[model samples]
Target: MKAVSLVPSLTEAVAVTLPGVLAGATDWCTHPADLDVTRIGGTKNPKLDRILALAPDLVIANEEENRAADLDALRAAGCEVLVTEVRSVPQAFAELARVLAACGAPGRPRWLAQAEAAWAALPEPPARRTAVVPVWRRPWMVLGRDTFAGDVLARLGIDHVHAGHLERYPRVPLDELRAAAPDLVVLPDEPYRFTAEDGPEAFPALPCALVSGRHLTWYGPSLAEAPRVLGEALRAARR
Candidate 1:
């Protein structure tokens, strides 16, 4: 099976879920190596002919990433397409399981049970909130309530100050950020790179830290490392 990924998260998801589910049964490939992603947004200027030529039995797309028109064409060509919309960590896991099941992988409940056990072992919440996590900029966005990032922060005992008010990945105003007054502002390296110098210029009054976007945001197998890293950040903020 050939998988065409326009987005990085989808790419990562396919990488983690497909092999385990397929049980290495199908040889798979992806296009646009080093697909210059500026933010969480997916592929631009995809090489369609290459993907079409692969003649995949299954084409997985994200409801947020893939173009509806493009998916339609693939379906019309007789490929079975499964589009997943992963808004939170649970949804991501469920979608992964769904894809795995569709690939004819057996014993999904066992895998999910193991994953749940790992998730259950993470840190508890703190008495106080610490930081705000912004995954994207330009329009100035944040990982808001109930998102993968929010869940990570919650696990780390760090409060997402805007969790109650904002939607997932919302474009928050600079003034609102100032008003929220988090102890530290976290700038992520992936999706968008935000530096300390950039922080002073963007919000002169706030302290900032450059964090690993992948660790804090990725919801798949990569999540194993997130709690430890985020726990460290939580400890640092307290110091």
Candidate 2:
């Protein structure tokens, strides 16, 4: 079963669960560090010609990460594109299983089971903290309503201040974000690299937690350790 994964998390899931099945992948599919598939391009702008040349049996993508026009074009060319929608942790697990099954895995992978168990094992937080999660900084876009990252953070007892916003990723002015009065400012490394020196200064009055984008955003093997990894970062910043 030849496949091309446009989502990095899905690419890792497929590569780890069923090795050598990937015929091509976007340039951003960086997990497994040693992945040797043909580089198609970025998720938002995949090279359709290159992907078509690979003649994959299936092209794996996500509703949020992939462009609708690109998926339509692939389908128009007779390539089977399996698009996934994962807005919450539960959805992520379900979608991962479905994508893997479509990729011809004999059964559910052990990592998926491990990830489920890990999240299930998390004890209820003693208290919940409100945070403003910034994904990008130039125009200052934040994680708003119904985002997978927001759901992941909510499970870890960090509620997004913009969770009630009308848009999923709203571009709020930096001044407005600072005025939101969140208990903490949670920053992830990707979509924008928010380092200690780079991001913390902006939220000088609030504690800033620099979290890993892969753990906070990606919904694959990283989910297994997200609770622990993200918890430590949040705790360290609070202290």
Model 2 C-alpha lDDT per residue in residues 1-239, reported as the tens digit of each score: 99999999999999999999999999999999999999999999999999999999999999999999999999999999999999999999999999999999989889999999999999998889999999998889999999999999999899999999999999999889999989899999998999988888888899999999999999999989999999999877673
Per-residue lDDT of 151-187 in model 1, one digit per residue for the tens? 6666666677777755767898777787887887777
Give Cα distance to truth, residue 103, candidate 2, Å.
Answer: 0.7
Candidate 1 Cα deviation (angstroms), residue 1: 4.0
The C-alpha lDDT values of all candidates are 0.61, 0.94
Locate the minimum summed-lDDT window of 10 residues in model 2: 230-239
Error of 2 at 219 (Å): 0.7
Off by over 4 Å in 2: none
